[model samples]
Structure formats: C-alpha cells, structure tokens
Target: MPNQRYTNQRNTEAPMQSSIENLSRAIFTVNRHAKTAPDPKFLYTLKRQALEKLLAEGKATKKGLHFSKNPKNSRQQSDVLVSAGEYFFHLPPTKEDFSELPHLGELNDHYRNPKANMSLSVAKTLLQQYANYYPTEDKKQPGKKTYQKPIFKRLGESY
Candidate 1:
C-alpha cells in the first residue's frame, strides 16, 4: 500500500516536472534566438543627401575638390573626391589610415564616434590634403599621385 501511494505521488508530479522543463526550454530558446536592435545614431540617409547637396552646389568646381570613393577600399560609404583618376583620399580615414593621423586626434575620435562633432579646421585640412595631393588635370602631372596598390580598374568607377 505504501508503494502504491508513492507511485501515485510520482505520477502526479510528472506533469508538473514536464511543464517546468518546457518553460525552461522556451525561455532558453527565446534568449538564444533573440536579435540585438540596431543603433539608430548613424545617419544612413543623411550622408547621401548631404553628398548630393554638396555636389549640386558645384563645391568641387569652386573649392577644387569633390567626394568620390576611396580606391583602396571600394566598399566605403563616404565618398572621397577623385584626383588624378584615383580615389586615394578618404573623408574620415579608414581604420588602417586612422593610425597614421595621430595628430588629428579630435577628428579621428569623431570618426570613431560619429555622434561626436569635429572642428571645421580639421575637416578642411583633410579636404585640403586630398586637393594638394590630387589636383585637377590642369594643375597635376599625368603620372603623379598614383595609388599605392595596383588598382584593377580605371579611376572614377564609383563616382
């Protein structure tokens, strides 16, 4: 009779144990499969609009510079002006180039943290560097300002 009562108790607990296991599995699955929400700080659309507006104003013709794409890296979103038929310039230097401009700490920091604002002078300096390095056809030599690496295609492919 005692064994029969123990068996009855065990049978009664089976459903509760099963329910607890199911609940644990559901929670584990939810947590394991959960996705992280994307950060909204990056201006995905504004960058393009800003570029278009800047180009439409003919800033390239007057300032002697324009935004294109970095030849060294074709997949970059921000455009660096084309010069001597090469995209040697990057608006905010890529991770590889960031270390080179240690003096421009504020600008580099701003690049790393997009939310942070950068000084106008630093921004101008970057643009000026590109302008000085890659002048227009009238000002630059045909062979000057070549890409460090062998570019597979002709320049202006992305711009």
Candidate 2:
C-alpha cells in the first residue's frame, strides 16, 4: 500500500515548488523592466521587498557577495548575492554582511537569469501582493498651490 504520509508530502511539495517558480519568474520580469524604466523606484522596491520576505521565510538563501559591475563614482562596491529557486539576485549589503558572507569577487558575465515569459503587468501584480506593497499616489491637494506668480512693482513703488 502507498504510504499516506508520503503522498501528502508530495502533494504539498508540488504547490510550494510552483509558487517559488512563479515568484522567481515575477522577480526576473520586474528586474528586467526596472533597468530601462523611466521611473523604476516602485519596481525595484517591489523586487527588494519580495526578496527580503523570501529570505525571511527561508525560501531564499544568501550565497555571498560580488563586486558591482557598475560601481557609482567609480568606487569599488559589492552587493549581496541571493538565490531563490533556480535564479540568483543581488541586494545592497548590510554591515553584518561584510562580516558574515564571504566575498565572491567579480560577477560572472557568462551567467544570466533564466528567461521568464510572464508579462510585466502580471509580474508587477504578483510582486505587489507578495511584498504587501501598495504604492501611494503623490497627488496634490485640491486647495494647495504649488506655485505663485510674484507681484512686480515699477521702480521704488510701494503699497
């Protein structure tokens, strides 16, 4: 007879695997768009938050650090490497990361994230839900004035 416990475990594993796969694909899509996006703040934030949540849940693991390819101001820098499912990502390193994770030196140019077929909208939605992020609109108050025309007076004229 088939073991009941084994069957139940197998059933549970399937869903977990699919969810992880979906999350990885969503992350890939978000990252790809963020690179060329005019305003990528929200996209990047979603990716970071989702990865952090996955790390906290043990669904992702930190591999180490890698030298940033495009360091700002031409200064040497590094990023924390994280692995989720079959994909890898980089996050800004913390102080503790310097002492904890080993430095992996330069990033490998030959390696690339797996191709993801998900649409940008779908990926954004999935990440927004997973990361529990709701973007706040920067709407101006109806009664608030953003600018005012300066009053001009000729010569030394005064009221």
Candidate 3:
C-alpha cells in the first residue's frame, strides 16, 4: 500500500510538470504574436525587466501598480462667447464638415446696398428653426411657430 501511494504521487507530479511546460509555451507564443514591430526584441522580456525594477523600487506592491496622480486642469479657460440675443450656436470654420446648400436668390440687404450675396440657405433655415423653437424668454414659449421674414428677399421684395 505504501509503494502504491508513492507511485500515485509520481504519476501526478509528471502530469503537473507537463501542464506547467504547456502553459509556459502558450505564454511565449502569445507574447510573440503581441509584438507590433518587426524588431528582434521580445516585449515580454522588456515588460518583465520593467516590472522587476519597479518591484525593487518598492513602488509596485502585491496590491497593484502605483504611480503619482497627475494634477487636474483647474485654470481651464472657456471658449469665446458668440451670442445672438440670449441664445447662440457653435459653427466650426471647417467647410468640409458641413455640406453647402444650393444657391438661393439674393436677399435685400438693409444695412448694405439694395442686395447682398446669400450662399448659405442652411444657416437661414437653422436660424428660422431656432427662432421658431425659442422666440424669447417673455414673448413666446418654445416649439411655437412664428412668422418671420426669409433671410434673403428680392432687391425690391416685400414680405
């Protein structure tokens, strides 16, 4: 019975060693595949060395990796304020991000001469939408349609 117990222990030890060897080979294969560059250096070896150095420095403990926390941006400045009355919108200067609408006829320019160029009909539509949704704080509630003149009218047009 003692001899049988000794044989059983040997049998279990052989399989355990083979299992460990298989696990190590699998780890090496994964480490090789994780390499992004075609360089001869193994990332696993580099990571192991770095971890050993950190451990020696007492910075890394059994709990987890530790490092100094970075300071937050407390003095971050706000963007430029551009408003139309109480409400305003942000439009990026990049042209490619937005699609250009087809040309609508020129509208009457009260400040300038008789008429001025109107290339952006979408802007007019957006402004109209905003005006419709948010007329004013005291005047009208949001989502109520309001009668407003088109952004562009004919040279002698009246609406």
Clashing pairs in 3: 107-153
The sequence of per-residue lDDT tens digits that candidate 3 reaches over residues 33-86 is 435546424334433333333335453322211121222375422221112212
| lDDT, residue 84, model 2 | 96
- Per-candidate total of colliding backbone pairs: 1, 0, 1
Sorting all predicted structures by lDDT, with the top scorer first, yields 2, 3, 1
**How far in Å is the alpha carbon of 140 misplaced in model 2?**
4.7
Candidate-wise lDDT, in order = 0.29, 0.88, 0.30
lDDT of 2 by residue, 111-159 (tens): 9888998778878878887888878888545886689898989999995
TM-score of each: 0.19, 0.77, 0.17
Model 3 residue runs over 4 Å out of place are 1-34, 39-41, 64-159
Which stretches of candidate 1 lie above 4 Å from their native place? 1-37, 40-42, 60-79, 82-159
Best by TM-score: 2
Best by lDDT: 2
Q: Cα RMSD (Å) per model?
A: 26.3, 10.5, 32.6
